[model samples]
Target: MTEIVGRLAPSPTGALHVGHARSFLLAWWHARSRGGRVVLRIEDLDRERVKPGATDLVLRDLEWLGLDWDGPMLRQSEDEEPLRAAVAELLERGSVYPCFCTRREIALSAPHVTDGEVRYPGTCRGRFASAADGERELGRAPGLRLAVEPGELALEDGFVGPFTSDVEREVGDFQVQRRDGALAYQLAVVVHDARQGVTEVLRGRDLLSSSARQWLLQEHLGLPHPTWYHVPVVVDEGGARLAKRRGDATLVELRERRVDPRALVAWVARSSGVNAPDRIGARDALEGFRLDAVPKEDVVFGARERAALG
Candidate 1:
């Protein structure tokens, strides 16, 4: 944590919403409060879902909100070559293997599970003797998985106090790369964070499980571990998390309705327990910034929030 590097990684698959802005603002505040720096990383690896001008819109929105980054923005797509190398290294280390189980097959195995989780039962953990064996057995390309050792990973979270997880049982050898050869988010994120010298990760609590998975990868890859703060997620009236894919209220739509950026930030500040003025910018909002001050529970967007944006 020497340099105190942080990042706002947004996948340019759709227009970003207020929830996205809240998380990004928190990240920017965390870094700037320490007189450190923030980096903007465009995670556009999911090609099919990536909109043509989504990246530009996201940058414009961030600028409009008055958040600044230290250097050039990084895009995940540009790191394809490095991702391939990392995959090769994992394969050679014997910690990675091909998992030929289809989504349907895996879903059936973990039938009792809910909440959109399809845990890997280690069905194909040892099915393929080697890469050669996997290649020969594959009628279709197989997804790659990392074998996990039985142990618990404990990491101190800044926002949420002491966190520990048994990644081995909770999550078996998870996918490192998809069957289509696209690198998994878990592996790609860990590699990029390490390469960029990131010392902290500030994102939503929905990805809390990811920390344990990424920690194992970091340990195996001999990379430095960054402190994590999984801030509470933004949920809708129904208590379901807001998602870009769900066509949630985006910044573009709100802007069109004449909603000011300051209004949005002020709402976020109050919602996250940051005492602030009626209107404020990112820098000004820092006056009340405190990691511990942020609420531990999720923020619900109801009728009041809808009227504020609309």
Candidate 2:
């Protein structure tokens, strides 16, 4: 049997909330079921937003949740050289181009719509220019953008099934490197996953659209594409999705409140209706749990649900 490798790549920008716990649980379960290795990767490339001690909080949370991962934890910040190398290779091959347009310029100059994010309009595609032959010493600070070809990028999601996205229609040419000298999420994630041999990706359905773009980048970089599984996202009573920045109910908070780890695990399982709320421990709950049994609908995390867990 082929080794099944899965990963939980979380940004160390805040505490790991319940939604993040669900994502990690799913990834861990998938890897354990297959007797595969689970990698813990810290996606802290956003230097400006990453808070001090956030990484330690993440590690403590995972350990508190009774999760163990193989190998030393990987940090994206330590892998910037390789990421830049990948960007440079793509630029030299004409697969990527330099973008000088700022976000404000693109927003004002293009017919962009807010599809939960600021969509880019291929405003700089025609204006893109290659580096001069003798300008090899121009350094790695150039803002590079991946040219999304005019075609439908498709992927077979493990849970969501068939998914496709017209990159030009949905999101125009996106950035691989920002003008501020930071690596973009889409580019960095693909590089890290490929380099680490991640065979499966388990994330929230909210990221399904972005997965299409990553698939495009994977092809351009000739990297091995991993199977994707997008789990349902946890929402609040108002149907608003939980966010790390929005003061959502976090695992650390619940732990501080003396909520049993097993109970929290059971809550996650119950949210998907994979197991009853009476499930006692992680091993039992996970043993009876089936990935196919998880509901595709959004799981609401209201006040009543919190009270029930306690």
Candidate that would win on lDDT = 1
Off by more than 4 A, model 1: 112-114
For model 1, how does the per-residue alpha-carbon lDDT over 1-310 read when each residue is reduced to its tens digit?
A: 2789999899989999878988999999888888888887889888988999999999988987889998888899988777788889888888798888888888888764523666688888777677567778777778899998888877788788799987777867888899888888888898888877799999998888778889899888888889999999888999988889877978888778888888888888888778887677788888788888887889987678878653
lDDT (Cα) of model 1: 0.85
Clashing pairs in 1: none
lDDT of 2 at 199: 94
Each candidate's lDDT (Cα)? 0.85, 0.82
Q: What is the lDDT of residue 44 in candidate 2?
A: 98
Most accurate candidate by TM-score? 1
Candidate 2, clashing residue pairs? none
Tens-digit lDDT string for candidate 2 (1-310): 7789999898999888888888888788877766789888999999988989999999988887778888888899998988988888887788887776667777777765746565677655655244432134444344777887788866699999997888877878888889887889999999999888899999988888888888888988899889999989889999998998987998878888988887778887676556555545555565666788888888888899888878
lDDT of 2 at 113: 72
